[model samples]
Target: VKSQHSERCIDFLTKELKVSNEKQAQERVLFVSARETLQAR
Candidate 1:
């Protein structure tokens, strides 16, 4: 289910965040995940 969640996240990022390219989408994911991790602490 984790893979599905990843796809969903990517889809949401692409549609809502308006990330145009694969590389930017990936970077945005990494950045968002990192920020979430920090916020969890």
Candidate 2:
């Protein structure tokens, strides 16, 4: 169940952000999260 949700998130990120590969997707996730964290401060 959790894995399925994760897959969906990855797919959504790939489409929304136009990341071409899994490694890029992971990096994009990190970048987005870091921006969100700074914004939350």
Best by TM-score: 1
Please give, for residues 1-41, the per-residue lDDT of candidate 2 as tens digits: 54565566677877776656666665544323556679999
lDDT of each: 0.65, 0.61
Query: Clash pairs of candidate 2?
Result: none
**After aligning candidate 2 to the native by TM-score, how far in Å is the CA of 6 from where it should be?**
0.3
Clashes of each: 0, 0
Q: With candidate 2 superimposed using the best TM-score fit, by how many Å does residue 25's alpha carbon deviate from the native? A: 3.6
Best by lDDT: 1
Model 1: residues with Cα > 4 Å off, grouped in runs: 27-41
Candidate 2 global CA lDDT score: 0.61
- lDDT (tens digit, per residue) of candidate 1 on 1-41: 55666677787878877755556765665424566779999
Question: TM per model?
Answer: 0.44, 0.41
- By summed lDDT, the worst window of 10 consecutive residues in model 2 runs over 25-34
